[model samples]
Target: MMMFSWRRRRATRRMARGGGGGSMTELTIPSHFLCPISLDLMKDPVTMSTGITYDRANIETWIEGGNFSCPFTNQPLHTIDSIPNHNIRKMIQAWCVENRAHGIERIPTPRVPASPVQVREILDKIAAAAGREDCEECKSMVEKIKILVQESERNKKCIIANGTGNVLSSAFEAFSKPERFEKRVEILEEILSTMAMIFPLQEEAIKHLKSEASMQALVWFVRGEDKSRRRSSILVLKEIISSYPEKVSELGEIQGVLEGVMKLIKEPICSSSKKASLFITYHAIASSSNQEGFTKAFLQMGLVSLLLETLIDAERSVCERALGVFDGICETKQGREEAYAHALTMPVIVKKILRVSDLATELSVSIVWKLVKHESREDEDEEDGGVKVEALQVGAFQKLLLLLQVGCSEWTKEKATELLKLLNNLHRERLECIDSLDFKDLKRTF
Candidate 1:
């Protein structure tokens, strides 16, 4: 629509400069260039049953939304068949190339939509190849399926429509069989790869992949030697865990799963894998009934220092997930003690209040709140009281006060105010400098 409006103005200007024929090129796009529905130039032009031409995707979306009438004709459509208009497409491509100097890009030909029959055929091939020792054929079929998935959204819909999800679900179950324990590494990799191809489907398809056997197979892949498989496994697990939080308990039961998760956090893998590991850890620690055992294992795995180091990474996703895991773990007494023992823990947590996103800011405030609350109840323990003093020394007072000064989320504001009050009540004489500097502002707000 914007392009049409611009072309209209340009055409008016061209007509006003009567026969001057200057060096400036005319921007008069053909009237027939636009689609009737969207008013945008058609890329993959298709003729409908009503003899109306529209872009394939736009018309498909219309049909999928239960629109039976033709968009332009206002007539009831007999069928939804959209035959490709090859002549119009070729003309559009030629016109685009001719208008290259005017900043128009040539549209790439749209990939053919995967038919249901073709999808079923490919699924059959994949299923037949899964049982054999030589999985080269299976791998080849998966590669083809991946290409089809990457080609277009229509192909993904077609594959999902043809029950490809069950194929992948079956593959996961087969990979988990005890008899397949001595299988070749290539076969296992291919199975994981096949799942990865369909991993981006809808939730209904993803739900089909949540069996116990599949979960175990994924845990095996997470601890496997192949980096790519490990990466895929972590990503898939992240999606599944987010969708089904109850599965976290089952995932936690697998031996070495937690260790593998911690290993992923410590390794120099991609940020996605690290984020997934952080989420899995967060869910496990947050929902586990045995807080003592979970906290002991987490601290024993050296998550405190690893999380401290991760805070220094500049990626926001990594930072948000790291803080989430950190917040969940710090709820336990052992976790709190471990965090306090880390030299950089307090400083790093305070520094992230405004440096990262608001979510990070809230989590950081919660961590400090929990730490201070823990210390507040332990009046006799000199070591516990020392944490509050250390926090003051590291400028926690100033940071929390500043957090209130700038308008943050209501929760963050409340937490900061509470922490500040705790500090003010504990050491009234020590906070005189900060109070005098911003006393009126703090008094009015609190």
Candidate 2:
């Protein structure tokens, strides 16, 4: 009798637990139900199991009214399909029994609250310590703060360092800022002295002096009326040019400043040592190819005649550089006519070019190359009424061709190639000059 009552209690419990497949076999039923669609939980619950389990009249009405679905499948359950005897309900019940008879376990939800009060209190403590300044923690923090600020400032200043800290740029800017001339001059003198001292030690120091700012200062100083500063500036400028041949523009200005420096070189008022220094300065100014000032300076100082005289006694290096400057002067149309006139009247100039060794030969060839390029430009302009080619003298080309034929050095060949290319473009008439000679062969031979 007790066993029968227990079975009845189990059945009652199964009926009380709504919408899930009940365990008829177990006294303790499973906790979860299966959805009709997924055969899992009743995700969207419905009532289409058994007539005794759900409201059969209402479910039948809902299914007929198009509202009822299978609890496991969530599929529309028609009255014909879900009226307990429907074959589809039997299949869903079997699926729910197999898949989810073990039931769905309830999971507890976790809760987390904000900690604003604790965070604010910690921040306030830190702020109070910082404000006290006497706090031991604050002292270390302040040191870190100082370092960060200094680093930021350094980063800001580093941007201008390349331009403002540059010796030449500062010197040039000083020229326009006359109010700062005294300070600039002092810096210039320091830089010049450093340049001179470091030149023999490192070639790069000479390059720094050749920058536009340094060149501008040297040009201004050369033309300035102050004889003492001119003398000093020229001395330093010469030292720079002597070490670095690339700064040839200074030679142009040297011609204008020549007389003053020459006076210093010749005067008994200066010691022999000082005179020699001045002469070296004069030599530096005279040797540059790019500077027109050097030509004017040369003429002003009567250096053309002096250069001719020195051809006999001049050191090989000096002779080579001086001739290079002369060649540079002669390569342009104006320079060519001037040099040709000088060379024609003064056989010494021609002799100097003809008798010069390999170094001098290289310089002479470069000069010829310039002349060739200049002539070619003139030829082009003549076609456009820009200039008259016939107006140009013819002797230069004849001399250049003769030099190319006889010259065998690699430098000569390179210069010849450059000149040939220019001539080929402008004067096809001169192509025969390079037709027989292989530039590669000459390069190999040299």
Candidate 3:
């Protein structure tokens, strides 16, 4: 009496009509058309050497998961490759066409992925064309690669894995030289545009490009008339410095690299370029062998002014980086003096405390500590006087207390506590000096 078989059943479907009404359609599917692994209609079905057919996606997933046995048969696989099961795919396509009324949309034919051989061949052709002074052919092949990499993540990875990164690095090494930059501007632009998309570059690919000469070439591109190339060059420079932090000193040694990088910080083209410029500025100070000289150079380039402007308005990440770089600069005596001299410096610094991020707050406190540590703390007029007085007048005292009360990183708390104590001491000294003064003995005219 209770014999219900679930194996064979006619499913009912309710589809939404164009005007939001409901329509019923029943589609009977052939089970052979379903992938055994997914148990769904197979699109781009392919047959394994095991004689089992599956959707190519399912086969790929199974192979990638380290499984060698057929899912249904548990038989060991002799080959990892699968051939396209065109007949099954055609049948599935036909089934979808027959059920078009049930919202069954046709699956477009799959594109053939870019093979590794094709990428290598194209690069080879480009190199040959360039050697022959065939500019048009060379540019065409580079454009093809740009298109290939844009097709899919798999294609991009394949291109990089096949040594596309080193090829680009080599191109930069050859074209980035000032002697070649003019005649080669078009190809340089094309290559730079292509290289921008390939990020997280391998060190071996870029290790040769880290020299002072290469950096100068990069600066040329940064200072190039083509504004777009300038941004692209900055992005590449950022990727390089980030990868080889130890070599940041090499960049500092370059005659004009600092100003070029600072220009980007001053006039940001985009968020990524600005962010990259900030990072380069940070490492230039942080990783330099001669921190004193490097930081001094940064200060003299009006870095303090740029950083103040950034802290005044840059977003959270940019603000944090600028603060950190400022902190580094303030480590040197010249840097501290420059920051202390600016009218808006201490006030803007005070404004950033606890508003941006923990790291930012920490950097702000550290900078304030450096600026105040050696200031002539002797008594002075608050109207136009001592560093401590200006800090207090700018509401630094109240912000310090709030930072301590709200809590912060241990390092930040330590700096904040010390600065707070110093400001409090200044207040105390002023009060005691007034009390000890002989002004009380004089007559009040008012």
TM-score of each candidate? 0.77, 0.33, 0.74
TM-score of model 2 (CA atoms): 0.33
Residue runs of model 2 more than 4 Å from their true location after superposition: 1-177, 180-191, 200-232, 235-306, 343-346, 353-356, 364-407, 410-446
Q: Which 10 residues in a row give candidate 1 its minimum summed lDDT?
A: 435-444
Whose TM-score is greatest here?
1
Pick out the ten consecutive residues of candidate 2 with the lowest summed lDDT: 106-115
Candidate-wise lDDT, in order: 0.77, 0.44, 0.76
lDDT, candidate 3, 345-377, per-residue tens: 888987777667778878888888888777754
Regions of model 1 farther than 4 Å from truth: 1-29, 37-41, 58-80, 93-109, 128-137, 182-184, 200-213, 376-385, 398-417, 428-446
Assess the local accuracy of residue 387 in candidate 1 as a C-alpha lDDT between 0 and 100.
66
Error of 2 at 395 (Å): 16
Per-residue lDDT of model 1, residues 300-407, tens digit only: 989999999989865888899899888987899889889878889987887777677779889988998888888645542575456676677667788787777766
**Model 1 vs. true fold: TM:** 0.77
Q: What is the lDDT of residue 331 in candidate 3?
A: 75
